[model samples]
Target: MYILLALISAIFAAIYFYYKQSFTYWQSRGVPHLTPSMPFGNLNKPWSIPLVDQVTKQYKIFKKRGERQAGFYLMTEPIYIPIDPEFVKNVMIKDFHHFTDRGLYVNDEAQPVIGNLFFSDGQKWKNLRQKLTPTFTSGKMKMMFNTMMNCTVPLQESIGQIADNNETFDAKDVMSKYTTDVIGSCAFGIECNSFKDPDSDFRKYGRLMFEENAIKAMKFLFSLSFGNLAKKIGLKNMEPEVAEFFTKVAVDTYNYRIKNNVKRNDFMQLLIDMMDKDNNGGQKSNFLTMNDFVAQVILFFVAGFDTSSVTLSFTLFTLASHQDIQGKLRQEIKNVLKKYNGEITYDALQEMKYMEQVINETMRLYPIAPVLGRVCTQNYTMPSTNLVIEKGTKVFIPNWGLQRDPDYFPDPDKFDPERFSDENKGSIDPGTYLPFGEGPRICIGLRFAMMQMKMCLAALLKDYEFRMNPKTIVPLQLGFGFVISVKGGIWLNVKRIS
Candidate 1:
């Protein structure tokens, strides 16, 4: 009985000590904060509700608390959330030298896929990025345009079949298949008929990439719950099977092409040429290893397949909901395509200014990375403050909340494509808009994603009219897994316009 009483007293004392430690964090720095209670710290919501929603709520608190930045704990670790956009811009771009890494571990030796651009940091990232930049230039994109177009022809045929069958389809699912085919053809230099055959290798592997498992879920929670510690255990940002399958696919494809003297004007070909094979473009001979090849193809897959597919899907759904915007976009597409003889050529796609605005608006509301993450490599003192944050502080920019903030965007809940209009957009603050992120580490595949998106939209809008199906959830909620997706997907019924 005495031992039980002693144990209860010890537990309460531990609780009191934790609160004392957490509460003293901000008070000592002269930073303002709501007093934390017991062991939950300031992030109790994250433990109780959906994690994304918890992040969103913290964004609200930081924004309204009138703190330029707030001191808080993700459980026990201290993190700073920059409330003001100016501070965010400064941390992410101006002071980038102090925070060169995303703070995520890259166990490249243990997990090969983690060596890719998304997770790689410091000198290694710089070296790899320098070598790969020329691969996606305007000239190369033009060379690859025909490959994307060839896949689109199949997409159109697939749509025609769907329309004939009165299939009430999830535009998201269909677009995913279209993107899978395009990525397979362009990235791997192989034929993947995802539109005709659901069981294609590309399709299977793509599913493997995003499908969730208990291990993935636990790591996800742990990473958010205890990020730095989670990295020590060698948790990979991508699935192991996905990485193994892709590595094998890349090796087999490289071997088959070399042995058979096969060549295609695609990403794989460029990578091989860089290896001193047939070597187009008079590029110097450098041996490209399997990691080098897989990294390049994975970039194509990561950016090409998912982000574009999700962006295009949401745009279609948003346009269906807002007919006025849809009508204006259709007019722009018709005018631009007609200028190039009803074909979406490189130069012609550039002329679709209004279409660009609409896509920008879509990206604004549904940015693929709703938040930007960076880790401080050196101690950072909030501008004008004497408090120095120790190195390794995980910094976050909640683009989802900032983009939707009423101060930055009036009537923040409304879908207003003109928010991105040239005249109106120029008046808005530059730091407020970051759909593709900011600074040296912004998404490198922005142009590639846009070009594919523009082409697909042009083809679909030219021949079809889309309206929301009964299956679509109104005032859509963002899903919790993989990439941000509209819950229940964007279901649409189609009518042939031609």
Candidate 2:
């Protein structure tokens, strides 16, 4: 028993010394850093506190100290945080080549679905990005416009009923269903009918993908911090059941389309066409396998449904709190639709410039992706600084902090859409407002997400006026998850516009 205890003591001592050495990394490099603690490092109560909140808090602290850059630790792993927009611009846009990869955990051999463009790196990412770029073009968005509009019918009906009944409902839940149906139809070419059948497979699996628990949080941190080691042990970024469901859906959709020679204007058809082209005579570099196809499909569904829903919910919540802004937005929607013969067409949606401003303001206040992540692919010196960020180092851009900084946005907490008006928007710094991120690696589905959001808001705002429900907690407490979400949910009362 004494021998065993000595061995255990030795192991613990070694771990303590190792962490102590690791914690001094940023200090040795002449960078400002927050003090790190055992096990969790600077990430205190990670499972309880949202990662975005922690990072944003850190960003503010460093910025207030008049520092342009700072460092923090995620466990023993060092993360570089750039407080200056110039550094952010260099990392994301001007010097993007050195930081092309997101540095996420990807073990495609074990979890084939993890091989999607979002998680991939280097040559594979370049090839896949090249092939998929055409899929999200403005012309393609125009093609998928009608399909997006169709999904809003159920949304309008559900909200209209709530308006007529003058009932308070969870805006998050309603928007989630709306986006689920939209993504299901546009990405999978299936009608989700999430409003009618809340337990539908698409909705079930979509929820499963983003559902966070302590175990999931631990797995995510583990995989992110020790990516190679996790990959060696076959750690997966997604639940097996969720991966299997999305895979089967993609397979069934692809096979049915190919066998019957059916072609639709949605994303699945475009993917199928690409696969068919690759199989026939496409260049080897551009070829996509079945795993590749399913991976992209899953990426589309996950990103498409969740982020847009969160943005829509927050937009409604903001508009509810500011009745004057809501009224002006509703009037813009009405005016834009009037010019299009009272039909919500793609062109008409574009003409609603103020609606764009409203959404931008909401995203600024409550960005769905509050932080942007990247890994240094090569040793590069930060411009105008003597320090060099080593290769493989993780870097975080505090999207939430930058967007809400009083320096960039005057009266930062206010929900004023005029901040994004054409006359004033250009004055805002380039790298500061990253609701959809910036640069080549910026969100590929941004236009699609914007269209879905605008269509939903345009559809509902035309007939319904929403107000905050007392049930909603004021000074909204955000929840822990991959995206920005309310702790409980955003509840709003709906009344028909007379």
> Highest TM-score: which candidate?
2
Model 2 lDDT per residue over 1-498, tens place = 999999999999999999999999999999998899999999989877767888999999999999999999999999999999999999999999999989888888888877888898888999888999999999999999998899989898998888878789998899999999999989999999999999999888888899988888888888889888998888878889999999999999989988898888899999888887877787665446788889999999988998999999999999999999999999998988888888999999889999999999998998888888999999999998988999999999999999999999989998889998999999989889998889989999999999999999999999988899999999898875878778778999998876
RMSD of 2: 1.3
Residue 148 error, candidate 2, Å: 1.2
Residue 346 error for model 1, in Å? 1.2
For model 2 the local lDDT of residue 498 reads 65
Error of 1 at 491 (Å): 0.8
In lDDT terms, how accurate is model 2?
0.91
Which residue pairs collide in model 2, if any? none
Candidate 2 TM-score to native = 0.98
| lDDT for position 273 in model 1 | 73
Worst 10-residue stretch by lDDT in candidate 2?
280-289
The residue pairs that clash in candidate 1, if any, are none
lDDT (CA) for every model shown? 0.77, 0.91
lDDT per residue (tens digit) for residues 1-498 in model 1: 999999999999997787677677777877655566545566564433444555566778878877677666666656676778888887878888877777664556666655777777777777667667778898989999999888789888878777888888888888998888888888888778887798876778787777654566556656765655666787677777778878888889999999999999888888777765424545342224567668777867877888889998988988999888888888888888787888878888878888888888888888878767788888887787676867877777777888888999999878898887878888776567788888888887878888888888888888887888988888887765556777677899887875
Best by lDDT: 2
